[model samples]
Target: MNFEDFIISPRSFKTESWQIGSRISKGIKEGSIVLLFVSDYRGVGGDAEMQDFTGVRKEFYKLSQLDFEVPVIDLGDLVSGKTVEDSHYILQEVLSACHYKNAVPVIIGGSNDFAFSLFSALNFHQKNINYTQISNIISLKQGESINEQTFLSKILGSKNFSIKNYHHLGYQKHLNETDSIKLIKEVQFDIVRLAEMMNSTEKTEPFFRKADLVTVNCDAVESFNDPFSMNPQVNGLNKREICAYMKEIGLSDNLQSVGIFNYNIYSDNQLNHQLLAQMLWYLIEGINIQRSHPKERHYEMFYVLIDDTEYAFRRDVFSNLWFFGKDENIENCIPCSRKDFDEAKKGWLNPRLMKI
Candidate 1:
């Protein structure tokens, strides 16, 4: 399928040298970032209007680049298909193309089911995919088809796809079903509650630290003026907190794909668009900053004996980032928080290390 038939080019660009638009185009630079906008919302399992991303691009293009050297390309809006599955197929093709070229794809999405397309394309890239999601609800119940409610179930249960680790962040106890939460624990998947991430993004940072694909449900965001998501919750992360998390998502050394889903395009709220645009900007900024880290090996290793077991910690002397080693070797080290390092001395098994 010719990609031009499915993607309309983004038109927004600013005259300022520091504007993000200055770096966006159709060209695919190796190791660069590519943006895809999806306007179709049929997978939402309700009467949904096709989203208009013109305001989002306008706001994003106007933001200062902060002298970032990272390259970004906006491939424009995805054309809605005759069926929701048709849309998913076209999206999978596009994502696969980006993956083959070794470019990071940042998807501004139509619904949560878009993740199915992202997950499907990921199979072509590599095995043992580490998928991470930030959302306020867990809707993994089996449905008639792949929609927002059953996308996670489709991904986790798919025989063709191989997901090594599935991490759920920002989940609220009230919004999630008891059975689904219990099922997650029974499977031993890593899940962090909304209350756990309110003031401390650090606890959640480790989740994103090594993630391959990260998806954020916009409903997880709290908006007062107008509902920014289809299932907007009364309590969720604020703009600043959400943006900070987006930066963390971008900083991932293994991050390859991302999606921001459930934005209520039916509403004419500029604030909602502005916030989403800024969140994307922060993500790009973070990718640029993370890439600038020195490649030279400057690790400082510390070993401790706790409860008859020896634990090893390694710190990047340059970036001050900490990692918990499975053994003495740095090659097996897993990204961890400074707090995890502190707790290791107290004989507490840094649970984050087990996921590695």
Candidate 2:
């Protein structure tokens, strides 16, 4: 439950990814906050040799430079030779215990697959708990009935889960498996495709609205963002675009937790570590913006219809609640405030459409 428990030194593991920082340690604690869960879980296997979580831990050190007090709990090792499901259950118990005292859990992970454990820990039992997933690839390989990346498939295929309220960003065209895309569409995940992000003028602001947790995957940001990554995809979003997206998402009114995963320190050069640091700073910037937004308010905007009909409405931008007159064409329209307009109209909002 202490900061010392969260960090692992490079010398502890004879692997490529764990070499950047001599010792991986948690950020400095200044807040009364209790537990923050972070770990280097690659020791178990599969892409273990390929993962380098050291850069992210380096980011944690930089975070320490800032003025804050929150202990980061490091869970030393991922249970070896166990299925992803087993890890999920194990982390679920740990996280539930950590959150019991209102502690914010920030997880540092080896792969996008790590999210399965974090999500399982979160439980998503309450309607108020909104989840947001950020990844360059959809990570939904449903047809691979017995594949390593079957976490998403299992979650969506299960009858017990109610995942209708989640949002997914950075879905690349070729990175997604066909069946995965089909499954994603069927599940109604709000996808902001790489093409759409590149082509559109807006950053993915709308998707982050009211989210309770933000899960980030380093692979989602092209290989350039993390040179240490072995399987970096060329078509991924650039560092700048990824930062902007994270900033917008972090600034959302309802976001309470944030996570960064899939960083491979082994493949990284000095440049990659620097980029990782910058990305972490941007993530914090997003949190700062959310804290600075104006207080909650119910406001109305009027628009004239082609038939000259006037619509009167009231909306809570901060919470995304809405009410309108019966005569208004509100069927396809949900209630939103000027906050929505501001977000939708932001200049650097969407980056999936970029030429890169």
Candidate 3:
């Protein structure tokens, strides 16, 4: 597939420019980080509203590359196909290309439906995929045609799709339907409420750890001086907290694909532009900061006999991270916080250990 044919280069930023172009050219030598923006919002299932991804892309490219060492490439904005499905196919092709090149694809999209395309593109790489999403609303509405609201359901119900684990973060209770929220727990999939996340960001890190793909709905962020997303929420994660989570998404050991969806690009707000750009920057920074583990370290193992069942725990002394399960590696072990580890010492059944 000729990716250049399907993507349009972004316009220059009004803010002060930096050495981003030079850095990206240099970074593409090894494993590069590629940016692909999708500006079509037709699948949002309303009057077609044209969105501008270039606003965010322009701001992203202008940011100073202070400590950025990773090879980066801007594939530029994706030209929407005649139909939404057409766009999905094109996106899948592009993502697959990036995957083959060992380039991490960071997509800024018009709607969350793009996530479905991302998952489809990623299907060939692995079985039993570990997927994580940060969104404000849990819309499982099964519509006649695929839309932003029904996309999640389509993914979950698809016969070909293989989902190992799905972790949802930053969901507000009021915005979500009672039964839809109930179903999350009834199915045993992880769902963290907005209140829980605001209380502690550390607890949510485990959800992103070793994740294959991560997607964030921009609507999950609270609107500040300007609206942060197309579907703006009056209450949600603040700018700092959302960016912090983005960094964590980049820190994943098995990180492959990312999409920041539901952003309100129709508005002419500099604050929104800056916010999204910085979010991307932090994510890239986190990727750069990731400690590549070529060498295996000895994990200190601890055992707790709960109801005559021996539940094991492991700790990586170097990273100061804890895990629940028998194996030591993050992939093999269930990611757990220090609190989960501490509970095991007192014979408490570690919730994280049980599910895996």
- Candidate 2: residue 26 Cα off by (Å): 7.0
Candidate 1 similarity to native, TM-score: 0.94
- Clashing residue pairs for model 3: 27-71, 230-264
Q: Who wins the TM-score comparison?
A: 1
TM-score for each candidate, following the candidate numbering: 0.94, 0.67, 0.92
Pairing residues by index, what is the TM-score of model 2? 0.67
Which 10 consecutive positions of candidate 2 have the poorest summed lDDT? 347-356
lDDT of 1 at 123: 78
Error of 2 at 99 (Å): 2.7
Leading candidate by lDDT: 1
Tens-digit lDDT string for candidate 2 (63-159): 4324222233334443322444444555556556555554445555455566665555565534334667777666655553333266566655656
* Model 1 Cα lDDT, one tens digit per residue, 1-356: 78768887777655587677776778556888999988777777544345578888888888987878877888888888878888888888888888988899988968888988888898777888889999988988897777888999999998999998899998999887999999988898988898888976887787787788999999899977999888877799999999999999989878889999888877788998899999999899889888987766578888878878887788889878888884555546777888888888877876658755
Model 1 Cα displacement at 233 (Å)? 1.3
TM-score head-to-head 1 vs 2, winner: 1
lDDT at 150 for candidate 3?
89
Q: Candidate 3, overall lDDT?
A: 0.81
State the local distance difference test value for candidate 1. 0.84
